[model samples]
Target: MSQPKHATPEQARPFLEAFKFFYQINDASANFFMRNTYPISIKKGTMLHKAGDICNHIYFITKGAVRGYVNDNGKEKITWISVENEMVTSIYSYYMQQPSLENMDAIEDCEILSMSHEKLNELYNLEPSVNILVRRILEKYYADAEVRALTSRFSDADTKYEFFLNTYSHLANRIPLTYIASFLGINLETLSRVRAKKRSIKKS
Candidate 1:
């Protein structure tokens, strides 16, 4: 039977455990679902999955941060950033069996728990509850992405800045400034100007 066996501490303060149990794992099948996944320790700036690759795994960030972005020629554009208590993946590739146009990379020395797509399919067949859990995770990802799209398309610069700061408060200080600027869809110089304006207002 599958079980979350003897896992090294991924998080000093985990929201739940390996799978982030939203509820009690009362059935053996549910426990099995949890056990099928394993941990992946990623070095800072390492690529978890690269562009044009089939996304064969789903990653749950147990520690540190991850970002999924796309490249245009040599220019990289950050699209998504996930931190502890979150999951990251090229979901479109995973679900549609297509090549991923984005790359998933670590922003820090990170600990991740991942399950192969085939293994998760097996779990879904053995226990349908596992499918529900996967569905919920997908839902959250879509919802967050949709929010970002809406904000970027409809919101003003100040509004976007406020949302970005509110959503990822510490990210500006943690990640490279260039990545942060890209993630916000702002040019580095523009981001610098905005920061300077904020600091000026604060000093006034």
Candidate 2:
């Protein structure tokens, strides 16, 4: 089970650092933002949000990893993976207040800062700097998404695995190969062969 509790400054450090990087705000505004958010600890395999559920909050991963995936005729297709210092949520569902088509799950035991949709809107209205930080974050994710779209469509299995290594090499050994294969839009055998081929190249 995921427990949502008041977050201490230590637990909120990642969010604070990210926020300060883009928009430096005073203690008062920062405090207000802190008060509205909470920390949650979830074990691996926990489903943070499920398809058909309205995603009520956006999460900032402080530890571990999560993946956004969808059921495609009983098959699970990974849409994206997020690790620490990154934000994860069903974007359209959170922004439009609609049921999500994607499901978010923890791939490893995770600690995350969560802010409800209501509180997020309040912050947007009251704190102009929040908008600046969010805009910058969104712009970054948008660019990454564009790269992912192009790579998934045009790249070969080797190129895709190489791109995944460049982008998420840190997670390569941390998470399951099955999840990585799904995210890369390749099968397990192909990923295994690619790994073996890469290993041989490195050795030779």
* TM-scores for all predictions: 0.85, 0.93
Tens digits of per-residue lDDT for model 1 on 11-38?
3235335345543333665455456667
lDDT of each: 0.76, 0.88
Query: What is the lDDT, from 0 to 100, of the residue 99 in candidate 2?
Result: 93
* Candidate 2 per-residue lDDT over residues 1-204, each given as its tens digit: 855566788777778888776678778678876788898899999999999999999999999999999999999999999999989999999999999999999998999899999998898788777788789888888998987786588458999988888877788888799998998899999999999999999999
Alpha carbon deviation, residue 12, candidate 1 (Å): 12
Backbone clash count for every predicted candidate, in the order shown: 0, 0
The residue-level lDDT of candidate 2 at 169 comes to: 76
Best by TM-score: 2
Alpha-carbon lDDT of model 2: 0.88
